[model samples]
Target: MSKTIQMPALSPTMEEGTLAKWLVKEGDTVSSGDLLAEIETDKATMEFEAVDEGVVAKILVAEGSEGVKVGTVIAIIAEEGEDVAAAAAGGGAPAPKADPIPAKSEAEAPAAKADVIPAKAPPAAADNRVKASPLARRLAEAKGVDLSAVAGSGPNGRVVKADLEGAAPAAKPATPATAAPAPAASASTPAPVAAAAQDFGIPHEVIKLSGMRKTIARRLTESKQQVPHIYLTVDVQLDKLLKLRSELNAGLASRNVKLSVNDLLIKALGVALIQVPECNVQFAGDQMLAFKRADISVAVSIPGGLITPIVTGADSMGVAAISTAMKDLAARAKDGKLAPQEYQGGTASLSNMGMFGIKQFEAVINPPQGMIMAIGAGDRRPYVVDDSLQIATVMSATGSFDHRAIDGADGARLMKAFKELIENPIGMLA
Candidate 1:
């Protein structure tokens, strides 16, 4: 008998993953708790451990294979006294087919093992007729650049976008607003381009999307198209919170705990959610799911896309604790070493682009989560206080809520509660 190893759902939301590497080859024996492979999940790279000890009879999925679906048989292990070759042949099922790319004329180009790696440039053109990609040919024609003059930079003397870097882009001819629309060249639809024509004459490179980027695109597109989002913006005074952070940092300096603005904001949002439970809910097709605990998903931008690492029971964790936890999670996230449990299943999210100096912006909701708070940079601004105008440090925050689950009034109240907590500073702690 053989034991089948299926591609794992590393995160709760993970439907597929990139089989980044195989730590063990065919015929290698692995014990329980041993690291078997590195699986690149939707958010991070996680170590896949062997749960049952056995001899690796076969690997159905190749290393570096992207978009491996969960529950698909990826390998087979021979049980004790079992024939390795027979077990390998008896592997559960064939690898699943990858989801077909959306029918927007597929990019006509040779895809590398991973991202499109630009081939190193050759010393000179190999042939009289310059070998170039369809996109390169179109671009060179449009720009009137001599293809022979550009050196080959892609595999096998092929001229790719990278070779055009020094060349100028073709400018689009102007069209007056009053001009009539041009008709299609043919009555039928155009065939898919092996390489989409690039109107630009300038040399550029097309980097293929990685697994993470693909998932982000699909999820965000679905979020915008399906979710009924209503945004509510509020201006919050941050002077109190700033002071509290400074004082807290000084007191905790000996203990080596430092708090960031985002950490404090995470606490405030968590408390606010608890105060206004009506707003802390998810739309479950038929009804709203009101969560009891406030688990905050703090957005962390990684190499290819953004991920939200959760702080479970954020309402119960102190500001200092949140800071420590967030720092650990963020560092691991960047290194692609986070566990599935560390980054999944949060009630709400908080995205702070303050460090990037963004004034304010709205964030898309992660599916199954009701809301996301977008935080902007805090700076000195004129405000009315005590019947007098004064300069105070203030920031604009926007909340994007799922209208299906949370009403307009509840959304507004959640924003008010968040603002009050930041303004008072002490309310979060209490």
Candidate 2:
């Protein structure tokens, strides 16, 4: 028997991916758990592993093929002693199975009446059932191209991948004044119109967007449009925290553990979320999810885009442990080797631009997560210490909360707790 290997879903939100490379070619023998190919999903480039032992009979999709839909057959594996040529010839798309209809019980069956005529579906409903290839449909969705408006060039007027190339998205219909206004654009919203480029004879290079960059653009646009963001900023003296970090690093010098200012702040945000649980929540339709433990997503900028690698149970982790974990996560994130689970879910997020000398800025809230804490650079400033003029190292921290799930007062309280934790660095350790 031969096994048909279809494209695997690399992540929960992966609809399609690029077959970056093939490790095994036709006629190569592979066993279970052997590396098959490198797939570039929206999040990362992951290695696909084989599950069954067999010889690679054929490769249907070529390397560097983009927009390969999930469950689309990519290759075939012929079992031991099977004719590879025969398997390759017969191993195209699998036959579509007809859905089995269940037999209705006599007591539950509705009475058939000659007078009851079946209602005709509207023209628009019929038009929505446009014939299109899976790749064409996926490309149309990403590019916001309307299949009904596109002129197909394939057999029987079926929409093909080439039909969507350079096709403009359909314009939205105008809404009537009497109708209620639609909500802000969300993840399900169609992609906005792309900005046209004009070089004006200037020498410039046009770089194609990678899968990661496309996902980031779509997600951040949706976040800003749909998520109601409420930013609360507070200035806290970082002198104490800085001093504690120095001492802690000195104590851990023998163990080769060093703590960065951001590590202590991550601990601070995690503990603050624990202290003020109201701020640590997710907004779902009709209900809100209150988290018991804080899983903090730390933002790391890579070549293509930014990624947040989560540090689960950050509240209970020590600064040394947080530093170690963060270092590992950040390195892996930059290498694009993190698993989907490592960057997907979090109770909240933390983004620090202090290394770049950023004074203060508000961060967009990652969807479903309640809030994100943005950290600014710490600098020496004149301040009143015990009612007297003094110099202190202070940093401005801003918390961007989802107004739908968290109240302004709760957000303020979380900021207050974060300030206290940073000021009293010993409490975080305790």
RMSD for all candidates, in order, please: 8.9, 11.3
Native-vs-model 1 lDDT?
0.79
Candidate 2 segments exceeding 4 Å error: 91-199
User: Which pairs in model 2 have colliding backbones?
Assistant: none
lDDT of 2 at 53: 98
Flag clash pairs in model 1: 108-194, 108-195, 164-203, 165-203
Worst 10 residues of 2 by lDDT: 99-108
- CA error at residue 375 for candidate 1, angstroms: 0.7
State the lDDT of candidate 1 residue by residue for 250-319, as single tens digits: 9999989999999999999999999999988999998778899999999999888888889989998988
Per-prediction TM-score: 0.75, 0.78
Name the candidate that leads on lDDT: 2
- In candidate 1, position 288 carries an lDDT of 77
